[model samples]
Target: MIFLLLSIICSVTVGVLLKLAKRYQINVMQAVTWNYLFAIGLSLFFFKPDFSSVSFSLISPVYIALGILLPIIFLFQGFAVRQAGLAKTDIAQRLSLLISLCAAYFIFNENFDRLKYVGIIFGFVAIVLTMYKKQTSSNNKYSWLYLLLVFAGFGVIDILFKLVSQLNEIPYTTALFVIFCISFVLSLAYILYLAIAKKTKIQLINFVCGCILGLFNFGNILFYLKAHRAMAENPSTVFAAMNIGVIIIGSLIGILVFKERLSKWNYTGLVFALIAIVLITLSKLHAV
Candidate 1:
């Protein structure tokens, strides 16, 4: 429970940090590209994943896919947060939880009862609430498109991680470490391209921002891995907690810290989203 809570907190703070980074004039791709470089170091030190046990034939393809997907997802998320702000962006991203759950059910043969079904419906409601727009202007009109891309990218990333975990036949820690290594190599390639193209100046502060993002990201994933392992028997419940908790906490922080505001209708939608979260928690507790 404690690990689950901690993971949620870290996940929520990540958004706040990334949004703050934008205020520092950091471009999305540059910030995320450097983030992966630093993430490689932390993943190595903490997980220390050994490739010796992995069957190359089975894990190689998944690793490659993960390598490609990660940077794309991170880039999309950074753009989404930049355009939509953290509150709505996070709400959109949280929809991936439902996508992942559905994939796990049909593809992985996970089971859920009637109450869980109710929770899933609530989650869908939250998604609708998230996609709702409070104000529409020329600039912000297309914001939903960006957020949707973030949702799609995040869903694909989640499914890829699950597939990699299954194929590698290793703990989530090692699988994450492998993914990070591959992603690091890819990010380095991107950094080199940026350097050659002179797209933007890579300042020390940019690298430092990436390092900070990497550290928090490592902690977020680490706590999540621990929570998942500890609650392996109730993985769905943990997912439920983490997803809704991240949205609520993250949204609150965006409002309080960043002064994000929603319309009256969107505020009502936020209430529904909160109710959905309660339903999810109640369903999980009852299942237990």
Candidate 2:
């Protein structure tokens, strides 16, 4: 669907922008903090989320958790791409589907046929291969932690979003607004702390970059949710499409646009990623 395609493009664009930010010497932390500001503004202006419809009596804990978690993981992602490479960080984030798929089976009690089983198992091999590199930084000893955090953080966030979506009482836009508002508060506080305590100067370029990032970031979520709603009966279809598209585009951008190198093992992992997506999607089709 067009929605899924747009979501994938927006997601990859965000990664590419972050990668470019490092080279441009932009203040990523400041930009990210302000990104929440612009995202909140965009949500209010376009979505115009109804707050009166939301009540504490029917509050979802998932929303509360995401408010803080979203910004924290966002910062981790920036760190991941900057410290590791774009392709590596992109794979880590996209591979989060592995965790979500496992959760769906064990925790959510979703059924998976043999095809899904094969796909899930193959994803692990892809992850190990993706992490392999010919020559990493001397900082490789601990730097991988950033990429690992991005992987786990996004998985947990996806789980929380699913939980929120399942609740019929909570309007999705309202929940999103609440989450963004909390993220804005936390991010703004951090920015203020840096200004007062660390004396880090906030630059206009940060807000400029934040505005651009916010448009794509908001579009990513908007289109993703729309795609899911359009294909509600077959979520795996959207999931497979989104992950595969990001992995493919992200890899291409990193390799061609950014001139980032990947080892043979990494390329092998990418091939496995495509296979996993096919198998997973086929399992959904078979179920249907």
Candidate 3:
């Protein structure tokens, strides 16, 4: 439970930090690039993944795809947090499980029960409602697009990671390390391109911010994995609690601390999101 709680806090804190980045005028790309550096270091230290026996020929394509996608999705997440409020961004991200569920049904040939179908329906409704923003001349008028990208991007990443997990050639942890290393190299290259083409100076502040962001980002993964190990017999409990906890906590922080306003429809959407998660969890439990 402690690991679960820490994971939730770390997940929400990543959003909070991204939110703060905008206010501080930090370059998100630089911060994100530096984030991968720290994440790579952390992965090496804790997981100590052995890649000597890894078969790059077999997993290179999947590894490369994930390598490219992780940093890109992370950048999208930062943009979404800046354009959309934390509440909406977090909801969209969490609800991305719907995409994974669909893939399971269609691609993986997994069966779903009535409750899961109902949950999927409510999840779609929640997305539409929560993303509704009143007409405003503000620059954030198109923020909903960023929210959508965040939702879809994460969903795709989830699918790819699931694919990686199905592989027998390499351990998941080792695959994670390789992916992170690749992400770092790619992100660094982009940062270098910006420096040369756009004359964007690599600032110390961005590095500092990136390191902090990486700490929370890695912590989120670390604690979530820890929670899973701690409750190996009750995986559903960790899944349900982590998702529900992030939504509730993120909404509160966005509304109260950040003063983000939500419409009545948005509030309704949030309620429905919780219901959707509960239904999905129940469906999983019933399946077991």
Which pairs of residues collide in candidate 1?
A: none
Error of 1 at 7 (Å): 1.7
lDDT of 3 by residue, 212-287 (tens): 9999999998999999999999898898899899999999999999999999999999999999999999999998
Is 1 or 3 the stronger prediction by lDDT?
Answer: 3
Per-residue alpha-carbon lDDT of candidate 1 for residues 1-288, written as tens digits (9 for 90 to 100): 999998888787778777877687876566676777787788778777776765555456777888888888777777767677888888777777667768878988877777667767876776676767755677777777888888878887888877776663666667677677778788878777887897656677777877887877878888888998898998868877887788788788878888987766556656666666667567667767
Per residue, candidate 2 scores C-alpha lDDT tens digits across 1-288 of 999999999999999888888889988888888888899998998789888888887777788799889888988888878777788889989988888898999889999899999998888888888877645457655547887898899999989988888888867888888889888898889898999999999899999999898889999998998999999988878988898889988988889988888889889988987898789889889998
Q: Tell me the TM-score of model 1.
A: 0.88
In terms of TM-score, the best-performing candidate is 3
Report the C-alpha displacement of residue 56, candidate 3, in angstroms.
3.1
lDDT winner: 3
Error of 1 at 229 (Å): 3.7
Consecutive 10-residue window with the lowest summed lDDT within model 3: 51-60
lDDT of predicted model 1: 0.76
- Provide the lDDT at 226 for model 3: 97
> After superposition on all CA atoms, what RMSD does each candidate show versus the true structure?
2.5, 1.7, 1.1
- By the TM-score metric, which is better: model 2 or model 3? 3
**Model 2, residue 237: displacement in angstroms?**
2.9
The residue ranges of model 1 lying beyond 4 angstroms of the native Cα positions read 54-58, 168-171, 230-237, 281-288
